[model samples]
Target: MILSAPSKSADAPIPSFDQIPCPILVTDSAGVVQSLNQDLLLLIGSDKERWLTKSMELMFPMASRIFLHTHVWPMIFRDGQVREIRLQLLDSGGNSLPVFVNCQKTSQEGIDRFTWVLFVTIERSRFEQALLESRQRTENISTALTKSEAFIRGVFEATSEGIMVTDSDATIISVNPAFAKLTGYSQEEVIGQNARILKSDRHDADFFLATFEILQKNKIWNGEVWSQRKDGSIFLGQLSISAICDQNDVVLQYVVLCSDITERWDREQLIHQMALHDGLTGLPNRTLLMERLGQIIAKSQRDSRQIALMFLDLDGFKKVNDTLGHSIGDEVLKTVATRLSSLLRNTDTVARLGGDEFVLLLDNPENSEAMAQIGARVISIMNEPMQFDNAEAHIGVSIGIAVFKDRTSSPEALLKRADEAMYAAKAAGKNVYRFAE
Candidate 1:
């Protein structure tokens, strides 16, 4: 009937403390080590005999020892526990290791003692610093992007050329002030509208389709286009369209820039006409006549057909210019050109070389008889009287015809042959036709 009966049951297993992975310690109230696990002895490169009965400050750096005395120990005594307290420890080789420590204060045998668990944190500190630096770098990039967008917006607002931005579907998203001025529409009126709002009837469906096809392939289209203003007035502008793509090369937007170029284009047309046509009668001058002659000669050679090149000079043009003044002479010349052009086929061309000399081109002439009939009709038309203001003026024409069969004759040689034949007609009584042999 004694306690010896309870002890006779079985042998209970002893718990193994060395199996714990991290460094663990037992310290008295004064932070003097009473016991340490084998893991801590191995971690600090020290034996248990060297640490027993020694102050735990032996394992801490000078700064961490001061912090332990000043902050960690006081907090542990007051709170009875401390958690995740960061500190540094000195190893046997004097290398400092960052660590996180957790401690619990307990009463054993009426005395205060502490159980400490420590974790190495050098690699974790490095990882935390890397995360902080990554966050800072992302912030810096965001700031830079904001500044870049501000710069782009300033340029968009200040540029002189009209700019319009659209989505991939060609719906307008933004318009600059210059674009509003050019199109007579305010920004509020244009946003969300399709670019077709500015479309003029000048461009057909085929034209737009071809243009868009080229733009899709090349990502740019620059040309003169007819556009309409908000007031329904049509105008010409030099349009430049560009595609905007994302990092993956997907089309995100379209940008249209335009400048009014109508006046400049009209001036260019005027200069072109002045260069190729006579100033008085508005007939094709020598430059244009030669170009037409070369093209017709090529066509006649390809078709194995004939083309007639006629050279004519007014019979008494110099007499009229001297007697009735050059003003009336100009009127007579205009009348002669009109009559000659009216009587010929639409495929024919009549051009003035200068002064009172004229040339005509007729493609696909039938025969000599047909040629003679045309030549006689031109002479008869020229012989008619022309009313020049108050008085009437009469002028006759002497014609020379040069027939081109193939590409064998050059344009200059052909014109020269016609010139020589014209003089022959003037020699043969001054009012008839002569054919170049």
Candidate 2:
């Protein structure tokens, strides 16, 4: 009976080997399948009895199929020990699935030598798919972080305003190129240092202490102040500072944005000069001169003081202009203005009321004699000839003096009286001074 189990190693098929849960195949040393379990029918999708008896090589025609015949067969045939291996098994449709297989030889008395068992791997396939998806998500997150960092770097490198990041303790951590250019400090010199290294000392200790105390309570500050540049040149700046905070409401860092306003200050001063002074002769113009005269009139009315207003006109200026052009007239007028201005007190004001006409505002004059003395000094200076571009030009003055008593009420009326006296002086010949009634 055992004679039917063992044979020329190929003819006899193992009996009752077809009912196990794991698929099993019994083959001889020649790699021919002499028998297979019932599970092999499900694994390979084949119910044909002849397939169970076919060679194991016939089930797998892959290039690495030699594993079953070479390493597996030799080990089982020589040592009688089971060998474990990892490989793929081809199904009836030629789709391959990975499996772990074990092969061994049992002494069947007359049975074939090598038998192998294969277990299907359903859970391992799902686990491997999950691992691949996890790795793909991790790679995508890493790429996004890299792109965000590159974009932030470009913003820091390209911005015009100096940018710096400091911790809550005021330690400099990172800075941009504009910060280095603005502060005259290099990155190597500033990083990891306290931010006070850039302090300009423009603000006093108490000023800064009060400012930061307010900021610590409110976390923001915006204002204008003076600052020192790289070469210690003082400049005005508009500054804005803010604090960045975390989710827990703790401050993370401080951000400061500053803009230079020195040019704006210069322009403001220029506008003031243009408004208050004459552009040509650098003297007070009509508008500011009137303001000063109004102030003097008010003061004289209150204090019971004597004041004087003088209106001066160049004699024969029209004839001079007709002969030598307005350029020489301007030089003559400028020369006359300079001569008359030198005779006034510091409290007095000299102004050009426009073309060949000027006004002198004398504050608290002691008497009409003093006013007449000032008028005489002006007349004497005007007698001296002025040097022009081509020749010496002589001019004379007609000065009208108006004396204000304790009750002089209006600057406009005083100016009108002075002008009338000046015209009377002009009527009196050319080089003379007269007082208004």
Candidate 3:
């Protein structure tokens, strides 16, 4: 069949394609109809008036619509011509008419236009069906991928573990909701920022280096980390890092997962303190006192220095408790502990053995004169008057000093000798001190 254009100049007016004996249609680059030959309209059983200004896509069969858009349109735009492309068109009666078409883009009076020539055929139904099935498969796969992405995004945002994704340089690219919540930063605040913004000073360079070394070795690393909040407050967290890489084993991004463990760490510290401290006065109890005495005795033997263990018992303390109740007696014991701690060096240890009884360990006490002077100072402080909630009270103490110069005596034996000397002090006078012979 032949397709021709209309007159271009006044002297040689060309005949229009309507007089041609072929089915042809013309359109703009955007697929909007410009004109069509009568034979073409007749072949599709449609009138020119009804089809003139509509998009060419409107004439394609429902199943072939996607193929026309995704394949035929891109082919025309890229190559500017398409040859023998199989397509389906809907007739005026709404029935499919399969045809092979050739389209070419041309310019008419400086306006871009596409001319399509179609040849209606009865064969090639199988090829059309195959194309349609392939398009359907692509659409189905796309839908499934979209749903999977939505499910994964929901879990990432909803989880309580803080999740962060960073570039290879440790610059944060994205963060989940829990990450923002944990670090007290909004996603907008942290994006493009270095992950170091959340780092606390508690970790040294070696600590971070070791962590990165673990990641390099195992491709994943997890450990305790100290992180800082947006408000500059410090917190402890359990951080896990993973190196996300491409299939070629090239590092691309890092994924970090963290959980705040500050509360748990604080509870552990409190438990440790409770195990070694007297609950009433917050001083070392018998267990910690024994440990300290053992350490001191070992040091004294190595350094050839004398260690003094002073056992002090408050004289006439029961009378105060009997008259004023145990609450006031507890206050007195706390006060005594405070006074003894204040008088000693930091290297020394003062502990509360039990009610109205305290033990002081002094290292390198110099001589027995110094030991006696310390004992007398303790007695003088204990004899001072104490005021408790509008009640004036007086108490006294008797101290026994046991000096250890050699490793002959154990901690228990030294404590026993100090206790015997304390009894001697109490027997000699109510408010005096004695030394173990």
Provide the lowest-lDDT 10-residue window in model 2.
Answer: 1-10
Tens-digit per-residue lDDT, 319-399, candidate 1? 888889988888898898889889888888889999899999887889878988988988998888888678788889999
lDDT of each: 0.88, 0.79, 0.87
Per-residue C-alpha lDDT of model 3 across residues 283-396, encoded as one tens digit per residue: 999889889899988887678778889999998889889988888888888889888898999988899899888999897888989888998899888878888877766899
Q: In model 1, state the lDDT of residue 192.
A: 95
Runs of candidate 3 exceeding 4 Å displacement = 1-149, 246-250, 298-305, 406-410
Between candidates 2 and 3, the one scoring higher on TM-score is 3
lDDT of 1: 0.88
Model 2 residue 239 distance off true place after TM-score fit, in angstroms: 2.1
TM-score of each: 0.77, 0.55, 0.64
| Best by the lDDT measure | 1
- Per-residue lDDT for 144 in model 3? 94
* Model 2, backbone clash pairs (residues 3+ apart or across chains), number: 3
Which pairs of residues have clashing backbones in candidate 1? none
